[model samples]
Target: MLNRCIATDAGSFATQYWGRQPLLSPSGSLPRDFSDLLSGPMVDELIAERGVRAPFIRMASHGDLLARDCYLGPAGFGAEMPDQVDSAKVLAQFAAGATIVLQGLHRLWPPLIDFVREMVADIGHPAQANAYITPPTSRGFDPHYDVHDVFVLQVQGEKRWLVHEPVHQDPLTTQPWTDHRAAITERVREDAAIDRVLAPGDSLYLPRGWIHSAEALDNTSIHLTIGVAPLTVLDVVHAVVDTLATVGEFRTSLPMGIDPTDRGSMAAIATKVMAEVTDTVQHRATDISEGSATRLSQRHAQRTRPVAVRPLESLAAAEHAGFHPVEWRRGLVAHVDHHADRVVLRLPDRTITFPALCSPALDALHHGLVADATSLPGLDQDDAAVLIRRLLREAVVIPAKQPEHPTRTSRG
Candidate 1:
């Protein structure tokens, strides 16, 4: 997926461009255009027929985001749900030069959902998709930077993009472009680092904190922004700090009457505390590292979701689990831990336990083996069937017939 979005191979992107600089792949550089992921008609379907509501659908004109009421109203009659997109209102706004933004398309649209899931795995980061549709000769956003990295894929028509170097490089989620608005506004006044017109099949990659903005050309333009949020070293430090809660020394109360408001006294205390923490962390490095890795994995799992599962189909499959093959849920983050008498399957949301006898089956599934009851190890056929059935119902495994790759269809 990453290779498809860039003209260069994945290795070149990682070493030279990832989180460092911007790369613009000229039109026709990539293998194919992004119409397979999204298109102009798909945008209309979302607004007019998908029952899209606020947030999922929004509009921006010139440089400001319009109010929700401008394009959304009740669904009318049976639905009667306020905040659903009113197609008439959307058309009026679009005709008036407002850019329609389809947010979280990775969740709303099937193609994008599968595309983003694969892209996330390829990039080792959490990713999201949003479509920007702008009228001719208009800009939707002001010159600003995003805290997360983005890949802009031109789907239709053309748009001119101007990108300047970052005023603050590698900004965290808590650090937004607004915090450096003054610097960003000043930076854009100089010659841009990149000034190019992106047509269908073109792609651009921008690291976080790079100031950029785009304007539609003579025709309406549609594009997808795949935002990737990478985990930083600070995340690891935080997990290690959290582990301090298990140490009594770190949990003890601060010096009494510490004059909390006094800068001088607080500085002294901070110095002493820092030294103790640094020493403790170094001495117990191995344990802290192991714990921190688990914490980080849990954090990542919580942020991402497994591939979509079909409840009805899964239930039906569970009823006949002994015959067909099953594989671990694609993209599910799970860790299997064995104990004396039980095996624990830790998921992002919760943990599931099973008798120790089921350890072999769970281990095999966790390692990505597709199997039926007869193929499962360490368990009788009947017991393996029961285990498979339970896992199917729990959404831990899905039938092998389901494809994990994105289909060519734009709509699911």
Candidate 2:
């Protein structure tokens, strides 16, 4: 899908420009259908038919946000008035030259969710999406910088953008335009690092802290800004501090008499803290070890949107079909470990422990090498079918139409 949106290979875009420099892959260079991610009709459906609410959808003109009441009204139905958007009013506002911002469409829109989910898995980081629908010749924001990296894809019409080099390089998520507005405003007046009019299919990548501004051209403009949140050293520091809480000496109280306000006293306190941190820093990798890996994988698993599980239907199918063929669900991993007495399958939702005798069958499934329940070792065909049905009930696996690759199975 990235390649569908991008003009070049996904690997090249990632290796050459990601987090390092701005990339402008112009129109024709991109796939012809790149703009299909979102369009005017879909936006209409989301606003008019779906009954979208505030914060999720907002309107702005020259950087000032319009009052919610201007575009949203009382729901004629059961939902709160404040939570319902007045589609008519919003369209009127748009006609009057306001830029409509559709926030977090990756979560709200199905296609975007699938696309962003793939990117998150590919990049090993968090990614979010937002869309901007600006009237012809209108601007929505100030000449400011974002705290996260952005990939701006022009879906419709055109937007002329002026981008300046960062005033502060690689700013953290905590450091936003508000932190240094005066400096940022002064910098945008200076020459920009990149400036161009982005028509449909044009894509631009802006690293965090790159000052920029955009205005719709002769026609209504729609663009998607995919934000990639940077994981800073501060996150690792926080993780280490969490680790230091287990150390008794580090947890002990600071100097009793020193004033926290005094520079000399603060210096002494800082020095002691630094010494302890230095001692802890050497083992930071160990502190974050396999536990960190497990936590990350678990988060990815949890990030997967829930799917409908009709276990009763699956059970009925298995009974009629003889044996069920199971496949691993998308964005899921089953970390299987065996002990003397049990087999542990640590899943995204929960852990399952089965008797050690079932290890061969479980191991085969873990490696995606088993699909047919009848092929599992250590279990009679009937028992194997029963186990497979139970796993379907738990949503540990989905029914597969065909069998998987072969792997060594244990003799029972």
Candidate 3:
């Protein structure tokens, strides 16, 4: 997925352009156009039939965002949802040159959902998709930067993009483009780094903090922006600090009678605390490292979701457990923690434990190698069937398919 958008391989993209610079792939350079992901008819269907609500849809005209009241109203009668998108209002706004923004399409649109999931796996970061539909000769936003890196996919028509260097490089989520408004305005007057019209099948990769803006050219333009939020060094530091909460010394109050406003007193306290923290970190290095790793992994797991599972189908599979092939759930995050007498399967939302004898089988499953009960390592036929059933019930694996012939089970 990352290769589809860039001219180079994934390794080159990471080292050369991932968060360092922008890369523009003109039309025909990409594998294909993005109409399968989104289109003008699809946009109309989302507005008129999907019952989309506020925050998911937004409108902007001439660099100013239109209020929700201008485009949202009641769903009428049975639904009665006051925030449902009013298609009539949207038409009115769009006809007047407002650009329509479909935010979080990865959660709302099926094609984008799958596309973004693959993208996340490819880029090793949390990702989301949003589509922008702008009328001919209209601009939706002023030149600005996003805190997260973005890959722009031109789905339809053409859009002239103007890209400039950042005023403040690699801004965090809390630091928005608005914080550097004066510098950004001043910087855009200079020669742009890139000024090109992106047509269908074109793509542009912009690292976080690169200033850019787009204006539709001659016709309505639709493009999908895939935003990638990469974890930073500060995130690791935060996890390490969280580990410090387990240390009693870190929980102690500040020195008594220290003047809060005195630089000398504050410096003394800071020095003492820093020394204590460094000593603790050195002595409890293993424990702190393990705790920090767990915290970071759990946080990443929470930010992503596994592929959707069908409840009724899963229940049926569980109740009728057989020697059918079972595959690991897509995007499922699992950790195998071994104990003296048991093995724990740690997931993002919960944990499951099995007897120590099941360790080999669990490890096989964790690595996505378990095919069926009989194929499970170490465990006997009956125990393997039980484990498979339990995993199916727990939504850890889904039924891939049934075997052509029923294989007779043998008692251990």
Candidate 4:
């Protein structure tokens, strides 16, 4: 339950935030204890139960004169593994001095998934979100900046950060190592704008393209880095070209004259076609932003099949009639099918359909309004028997009365 303090001084804060000059956030603590949120017991459980992968982490070299001490893999290995390390030892190393931890956040336990969801919301993007935790000893990453913006939250313990101002103002992309290494070199020579320490509950916001490094300062330091997905002009252009390729006009060859020396004319035709492609791509961004928008665009676990329904025990008189209940559980999306003759419903992630009339029964059971078909309204013996059979087949409804207890219990 990390508490976040958004910048209150909008005027001054906005002026200094993520601009050419570096800035530090006003120190604040999180609302909840991180230990309680991610207890040690839970950490062990995650490692034991969940098939967690540990990707190779990287570190920056001080100079060519020194040898690189590779860990887990090669200098730039990003392999995945399933193993738990000493949390205290990693924290101590960060406290000693280490920068960056690759694939650190993706290894988080399930308890932290909610926190990751909220952080993605704060970034104002619907992209899939993940986090990396850097203990004191381990540098999860190298002394490099990320291509996308990041929201760093100190969940527990303490960490120090050194932020370097952008050398190339408003770069097309951050983490210039992939494209603009020359620009990164120039910026590093210019000098860092801010250096500060962050303790538990403190958060630091770094816009994409800014250079920065961090190290743990406490015995156990845990932090969450929320990454923002970047949408580039090239991406838009590519998308537009792909869409236009369906048109015959785009596939047709340009009007090339028979004269072999008319190369200049061919160049002009190519330029005009490229311009059209670029324009279409620019407009297509709006469609990509709206039509495909998801709450959390990141990949998630595959949805499980709906629960099976059980027969109603109260409808003993009507052997032919059965009832089954299907619930639209919270945090899940589903659809209902209500026809004049039959009732059916479908889940967003599954194709399973249930009787539409069963919707009310599911609601009643989910809300604890009825113990079983005995408490349902207008559900006669025959209807109850049919509903029970359907629910049990779909796994959407369960027995209200367990064998251990002869009497009916509250429906859940």
Question: TM per model?
Answer: 0.95, 0.85, 0.94, 0.54
lDDT of 1 by residue, 1-412 (tens): 8977898889999999999999998766235679989998888888888999988998998789999999999987999989899999999999999999999999999999999998988998899999999999999999999999999999999999999999998999899988998998899999999999999999999999999999999999999999998899899889999887788998998867779889999999999999999898899998888888889998888878888889998898888888767888888988899999999998888899999999988988787677778778899989999999999999998887733331221110
- Residue 368's lDDT within candidate 4 is 40
TM-score of predicted model 1? Answer: 0.95
Residues 224-310 of candidate 2 have per-residue lDDT tens digits of: 998877666666556556656667777788768768789987998799789867866666657554555565556555545433345
Task: Report the C-alpha displacement of residue 315, candidate 4, in angstroms.
Answer: 22
Which regions of candidate 3 are displaced past 4 Å? 29-31, 401-412
CA lDDT of every candidate: 0.89, 0.77, 0.88, 0.48
**lDDT, residue 97, model 1:** 96
By the TM-score metric, which is better: model 1 or model 3?
A: 1
> By descending TM-score, how would the candidates be arranged?
1, 3, 2, 4
Candidate 4: worst 10 consecutive residues by lDDT? 295-304
Question: Considering only N, C-alpha and C atoms within 3 Å, which residue pairs clash in candidate 2?
Answer: none
Which residue window of length 10 is worst by lDDT in model 2? 403-412
Q: After superposition, how far is residue 182 of candidate 4 from its true place, in Å?
A: 4.3
Q: Which prediction has the highest lDDT against the true structure?
A: 1
lDDT of 1 at 320: 87
Regions more than 4 Å wrong, model 1: 29-31, 402-412
